[model samples]
Target: MTGRLSMGSGQPIKLAERRVFSDSFKPLYNEGMSLVERAAEYLDGPGRVEARKLSRMAATLYAAESMRLTTRLMQIASWLLLQRAANSGEMTRDQVASEKSKVRLDTASAPDNAIGWNELPEAFLALVNNSLSLQNLVRLMDEEIYGRNAGMTDMPPPRRSNPVSDQISLLNTAFARG
Candidate 1:
């Protein structure tokens, strides 16, 4: 079955709240299986087998990353709340707010435009909050894809380190070759 690509509206989209199950995780399952199958078709004998093995490896990595991203999202949510508290001069302000304002994860718009947990400052409190966000995201994704505990096996996309890092690296490589 084919599925539609969804965009976040402005409100938050909690897949966990929706109670999506393993059956919902069909998209990812198909993707994982397809990667392995395609690798098998393109690779011959040992190479084909290796391709399949790599596919599985990629799937595993994706799952782990998905879990991590979920945790980070939760952390970000908590951090946002905490900031609100601190802004109001709470008794204990454990986390420091960013010098600049941060955009919250509002499903009311788009995931691509959403500020990710990783976008938070790389500091102690930020890291803690980021982790929480990741955990939450994974929980939600799992529930959304496969109801209950099924989402636990979700394979997510690779975690690209620092958004600017990739750009900088590409530029450096280009200049070095010149």
Candidate 2:
């Protein structure tokens, strides 16, 4: 039998913050809708199930990434606004660096099998990458709007997946046992 468990008070779990502002170039979400619409046009009834799954995946990844970038951008923008309001004269370098630290863009490695290296449609990897890049650009532009460095942004970490290797290793172990 399943029952709910209550824990004594402890440090609260930290939830990721969500951004409230809407940006103009919302590519990830808009493109997902487009993909869903296109797929729906070609499919019917049960066939739509697979298409819907793809669309949902696309939209979810897009939203997750967009939210990350948007949050960063908002922080940066707010910092800039605060600086402008408080400063009676030009800002110093150290002041700028401190504010910039709040919006640090950390690179994350992607799954290797994210997309086939050489293939059309390319497992939707291109779409994912493109969406991420656009998200970064949006953040960068916000920084630029506030008169910050728009140069030499770090590249995203490579994406890799090992499902094939994992499956093969499992098969080899099974065969050896047999």
Who wins the TM-score comparison? Answer: 2
lDDT at 112 for candidate 1?
A: 27
TM-score of 2: 0.29
How large is the C-alpha RMSD of every model relative to the true structure?
17.5, 18.5
Scored by lDDT, model 1 comes in at 0.36
TM-score of every model?
A: 0.23, 0.29
Best candidate, lDDT = 2
Candidate-wise lDDT, in order: 0.36, 0.39
Candidate 1: stretches off by over 4 Å:
1-54, 89-178
**lDDT tens digits, residue span 1-178, model 1:** 1122446766544543232222444443343334334333433344324324334333333223333444444333443344344445552322333311232332111122222323322332232333444444544443343345441233343344454653443344435432
